[model samples]
Target: MSGASPRGPSVADRGTWPSPGAEAAAHSRRLAGVIGSALDAAGGWLSFADYMQLALYAPGLGYYAAGADKFGEAGDFVTAPEISPLFAEVCAAQIDGVLRALGGGEVLELGPGTGRFAAGALAEFRARGTPITGYSLLEVSPDLRSRQQALLAASDEPPVDARRIPPRWLDSLPAPFRGVLFANEVIDALPCERFVMRGGAAWRLGVGRAAGAARDDMPRFEWRARPADGACTGDAGFVAAMAQRLDDLAAAGVTLPEGCCGEFHPQLAAWVASLADVLEAGLLLFVDYGLPRTQLLHPDRAMGSLRCHHRHHAHGDPFLWPGLQDITAWVDFTALAEAGVAAGLEVAGFTTQAGFLLGGGIEARLAARLAPPTAGEAALGEVARAQLAQGVRRLLLPGEMGEAVKVMALAKDCGAPTAFALQDLRRGL
Candidate 1:
């Protein structure tokens, strides 16, 4: 068996259905048509990457493409920026250094969820007297773009120029552009190719109709492995990367242990290359929950990190609620470093989010925010103090987002920033 081990029943069997009705079923049928058509084109099987692409970006029917809340308490999950202002404040410190080194440039952010991070970071930059040419957001979803615009407009930050780059203009990005680029929780959303190790060889995992399911409108998806001899998988890079990962596992005195499953992101190199191609100079910083290659592909994660988030509940079933929930996989920092270096960018530093925040003065910011007024000054409010403390703990505690999320930076021609200098984990990668 390929590592694409079967877990359990379909979404219907789980009893966690979302918004059931004729309308919802019709929506699924329409979206499934897109996926089914592609499956048909691929000879009744589509690579997991293609399946994921259709499920998340298929015109106006995919999850990200649909109108739905996807952040904070109301959304599937809460990001660091939403958890506290200190995250943006600390991130501002890092961005400030990069901007200062480049003598000021645009701040290009990818998938600016809720625009909360931008609002906070931009406000901090303004407080620090930093010069920002402009703020450009590259978002594909119209619904999300609207939310971001509304959030930014309501922010207390100064009136800074912020615009969304049109899809047509992505290929021909502004030339000679020099600025700091940032992405938060974006890598995990990138489509990954799933693979399983069967008997000593890796097999590509694909999506096809569940066995013996006759219904076309509500076709259940199942993990199916492509045949040997590299036929029908269509992604040579994915196969090669998965094979390399397996070899690495063997080198570490570990075997796939029959039925062990894992994932490989074949598009990471091109993704980094695209960013590096347009970014003429300056630094690129990305924050996400991931690990070094060794731990990411270790036997401990035999089932891989593929996950789905729906109404704050996480499950491994990506086939549930097709265009409603969020689907993501843990990032592999080693792949990121390799891609960045291959694109001619220098690896500045890599470290835990906790280290990055502390080194960037999150604690100082927290203290100043909660400091008592002296000499006939009023003290901070009890309720406000408690809330701030909660956010701090969530952001810095070892078991929380702190150690779970990682901070990595790639510089075009500058040195490592002090934020990451606090604890560089790049050597491990």
Candidate 2:
């Protein structure tokens, strides 16, 4: 329920597999032992948050921190950027509007995987005559950063002048930006805590086992009784459970050897603060796949959106492939909104990709430009026609990325907000 309300299966029944056996089982046991040993060295005891950090952020061995192919057909899954350049084309169109509003500015992007999104956006800007002054990318991995440079080197634009700056990681955002800052699917990378409601209170869920080969690896989803006052029980219950779990771990002197973790990025607020500072007179557009606080705080969303992707198999098993998986969680848009507000950025607009694109003339653009010519005109090849049909379906169909993904924008030091035609979905923020 925390996500877009995945209609495929009941979340309660998802990722509840008892255990794996044989070779896989043996590997799981070894991994658990290794995890415990590591945690013992770190501090003798570990919270679920600390466990997740090691599971996903352990130097050159953690999931994303490792040199694993996490995108495209060769990787665990394919993001829109890897699918084609078209995704960026549409995105660039939106960014153009923001930059123009800000009197023409630059761009700063985060975790631009393989650099395709940034490249495509830059190309679109050049082709559309947006006088972009500079482009900056903040990626952590040295390997991925180099890969991004190599990918962008093939740009068709004349004199591709861009800087691949090292973003202050997990700490602070750069200050005083005057351009359109954006990212695709970047918010999901933030950490989140997992808890289960039990005994009239929420109990923190940790990724560990009782010396039984780590039977449960996913967050044990739970719900607390709705409070009579309807206060935000989400944080209240979560904080309570976390405190109790820390107490228990301390009491037993047990260290989380090896396991996954769930956490929300308090750093998100910090990042937003940096964004507000640098955004002298421009807009910040963040596009990703997630819901708002209302949906996340829904009664049904007792379990959070923390999942792992490996070999195209989506689940909540961060321990399945230590150095060969992509771990992610749903972003708290409400948290993001608060971060923006805290930084003094006025919440200008928010909405889903479906509503935003449609309102911004997707259908109108298609009707005017994508029209089929008369018989007298030329014709596309069979393959071309097939590809076009598929492309149209992908961008317009409701069930696809057309609706599931979302777009949000915040502005500062601007004139009265000029209404852009896009579905605004920030109320939940």
* Top of the candidates by lDDT: 1
Q: What's the CA RMSD of model 2 in angstroms? A: 8.9
- Model 1 RMSD, rounded to 1 decimal: 5.4
Total clashes in model 1, counting residue pairs 3 or more apart in sequence or in different chains: 2
**For model 2, what is the error of residue 302's alpha carbon versus the real structure, in angstroms, after optimal superposition?**
4.1
Error of 2 at 57 (Å): 2.9
For residue 423, give model 1's deviation from the true position in Å: 1.2
Off-target runs (Cα >4 Å) in candidate 2 are 1-35, 42-45, 156-175, 213-263, 363-381, 415-420
Residues 156-226, candidate 1, lDDT per residue (tens digit)? 76436343221111213455578888899888888888888787778788898777764745767888886
Lowest-scoring 10 consecutive residues by lDDT in candidate 1?
1-10
Give the distance in Å from residue 104's predicted Cα in candidate 2 to where it truly belongs: 2.1
- lDDT of each residue in 1-429, candidate 2, tens digit only: 012222111233325433344544444344455666765564443445556666666655555565656666556655666654566766777777767877777777887878888877777776777756667887766667777777777656532533322222222355666777777777776555555445444444544433333344422211123222223323454564345444444454532222223235545776777777787887777766666654543344444566666555567655554445556777666667777888888777777665665655555544443467677977656665555446545554567666656777777875312334445666656
RMSD of each: 5.4, 8.9
Q: Which residue pairs in candidate 1 have backbone atoms (N, alpha carbon, C) closer than 3 angstroms, thus clashing?
A: 3-196, 3-197
- Give the Å shift of residue 232 in candidate 1: 1.4
